[model samples]
Target: MNSLFLISSAIIIFAIAYVTYGAWLSKQWGVDPSRETPAHTMNDGVDYVPASAPVLLGHHFASIAGAGPIVGPIVAAIFGWIPVMLWIIIGGIFFGGVQDYGSLFASIRHDGKSIGQIIEVNIGKTGKRLFAIFAWLTLLLVVAAFVNIVANTFVSVPQAATASTLFILLAVFFGFAVYRRGVPLAIGSIIGVALLFACIWAGMKFPLVLSKNTWIILLLGYIFVASVTPVWILLQPRDYLNSYLLYAMIAGAVLGLLMYRPEIQLAAFSGFNVGGKYMFPMLFVTVACGAISGFHSLVGSGTSSKQIDKESDAKLIGYGGMLVECVLAVIALITAAYIGGDKLKELLSNGGPINVFSDGVGTFMTRIGIPLEVGKPFTALAISAFALTSLDTATRLARFIFQEFFEDKTKEKQSILVTNRYLSTAITVGLGGLLAVVGWQKVWPLFGSANQLLAALALLALGAWLANVGRNYKMIILPMIFMFIVTLTALVQLIIANIKTNNFILVLFGVLLFVLALVLIKQSYKVLSGSERKGMKA
Candidate 1:
């Protein structure tokens, strides 16, 4: 009956209500879920639609619910649990959920294109191109950050790296068997993952491969193939298969939280102290995806929309899936909180946030009759594999967004097909390869700022979309403004710190942020005060 546990549970419950109510309101305003959904009305069974709601949810959760939810929360817990927990609970439902659901609803109504496409229809022409380019740039950063995350696991933890390699190999085999061959996918995925867990067990007998640089190349190859292949074979199937690993992670965390009942270990506040430096920038950077992730919007509208079998499922997929990710963040916070004090610091210095999550998962596994050493590698591999999911998905989503940015000429002449899979693959591989050079050490600091800025953009887009639909729109505006201020402030602080430290790349990113902020502010001003929105409401 620790107060923290009670508080965490309460946060999750409130988030569900907030998102569900918003979705219901959207139904009232514009969307009629029953009246000929694009999923059912235009069900093509291949890309148009296929997965059941539960399965699709699993897929969405798997893809969006990656290292961000796990690692970010763990690191943010360094500021003590309150700040991290507060951000996740409140931000997920109100901020992240709105971004996801609004983007999905907007995409569906606009004929299942994408957020970038919706921006053109809803925002002005310039807004569309800016959104497209911004989306692509965001994806590049996502790939870079996630590549670093996976690479870190490889460099610092040998057993886990081996497991991650096996997971990728297994995903490939599983992809070919089920996706290419068209076997019973769900059952095949189950078997493949089962075998993978067993292989992970066997991997402890082999030598460890602990070269972060080597893994950077290895992961690049994985992403290249993963991006180029058909969604049925690689993206969908890989995500579908890997979701069970997520399930295992959840199950273990729940069991440990109950059995060990680890006390909430972090203080209510830690004076914003990070690395003995100012805490504001570090906290923001560390908590990127947990509190608010722009990446979720990409998942919401990209592949998830096409695969959604029913419009009613939007609440479940967009809202529910995001809330589930929030809970994962809470679990991460709990783990770090339980570890508490100096031990948390020791673990963080000795390894990284991945080690903290691994330690938590390994503890649970040990309780369930596995050795610590064995559980450690198993946890590591699972996480590394999770990182790959993020990399591939982000690359693909970014590519689609990039191509959409340059598609005006093609669309005007009716020559550009939206489903240009070949071009998209090129974008995916090119961006992924370009990012693989950056291992985690170089990229971790900016993850939060980028993620939050994206969240702010999504909110503005949603606010505009809501106003277009004729709702009060204030609900959307409040969150949008809040995220804009907090995140911009955080980014500014990070920039200042980078300048003092003589970090040129961070300075460049700071410039990028200012540009993005300028564009968004202008767009938002037009949405709020400009007469252009009067006649062009969607």
Candidate 2:
């Protein structure tokens, strides 16, 4: 029941999986090192710029990690650390990693298209449209939920707000210097990280206090600009720099846990039914990002695939990135388990899971000679930074989906609404802003269900594509089927719960997403069946 044992075990398992299972997947999917990737062939300095493996990994990991691995595991701890831990390790390797890896690989092959566009190529145009609608709607939920979470964090921890602002300004300069001014990456990175730490110290000295609503407004405006700007100027560099904060936090936590070795205070199992929620589907849905998420596929296909220098980097950024998140999820579970029952409840009620994680990690840092005052705020700042990363990344991806939805291949010139980047981004962020005021608590359950369902659809698309190409698609079958059942069940429960509470808006969305899933599944099934028949004849 020692925390060190649990965390160390997870690290070892993930490391082994990265080399063995991850490499095996690359080979099975026919990763061609000699082939030119979209980043090189379609090199537009805007979204399609090529990046080294490390830079893309940082961007990919930061965008996908967000508050997901931390929030989901801590929140789902109501079902006990045992079930949550099992899912993080098992589900992360087989379900999440494969989906992320496959999605990225698939996108690069199809000219750096989003998963929805990939669906269009492999399944059909109708399948692509349906998937795009579902994916965009799910992204809206992501924008709303994370916007609320980050705004609240800024309100409660003003120093983190100050630090995050500094991080943004620093990233802009770093991007210009490294990408435009010909500053060497290694030296630029050294200066960037050093100044990043200074931002934290300066944040503590001069906190930027603001109301939650005010922060929400400012954040919406920030993502609007972030979504339309060139990736190298903001998105890529910001994520790359912010990644160091996470790396330091993780390293510090592991070092502290090794030295401190706190005992697991929570019970192994808290029963299948706790607080009128059944663990069957709720547990699977709640522990999403840590285990598997539909969202990661978006980050992989939507952004990272566009910047990849070669096909070889996809496995590292996709599969290896997911395993790294599983490590963070394990650390999050331990933080909750170490806090025991009463304090965990109090923290959840007051500041939510982020507070619980911050406090636990703050205590861990004490063993390594860091004070709680500094350590806790630093953890808060790191997490909020990533949440902000997800916010803007989601906005960009949503814009991509929205534009893709309106795209007509038959037309030579697209409409302004679709071609105009600002208009599309404004529409996406504006809708998400309206929902941000609804609060994350009201939106999380439906988001979880829809997010998982998105994963199922992505898996379905991957399966159909592999089968169509006569590749070995058996690896994708079980995860795709399991996600469909889990997410569909979760959506049903959410609909019933929303109706009882008289929340018709969420109920409507839940029903719409459900219908969309069924229709897409039917479309994909035909493709799979036809491919099987073709193979039999050949």
Per-model root-mean-square deviation over C-alphas: 3.5, 2.0
Q: Give the TM-score of candidate 2.
A: 0.97
Maximum-TM-score candidate:
2
Report clashes for each candidate as comma-separated counts: 2, 0
lDDT tens digits by residue: candidate 2, 340-410: 87899999998888889999899899999999988998899999999999999999999999999998889
Query: Candidate 1 overall Cα lDDT vs. reference?
Result: 0.70
How does each model score on TM-score? 0.87, 0.97
lDDT of each: 0.70, 0.90
Q: State the TM-score for model 1.
A: 0.87
Candidate 1 regions exceeding 4 Å error are 1-31, 35-49, 155-193, 205-214, 272-285, 409-424, 438-444, 501-505, 534-538
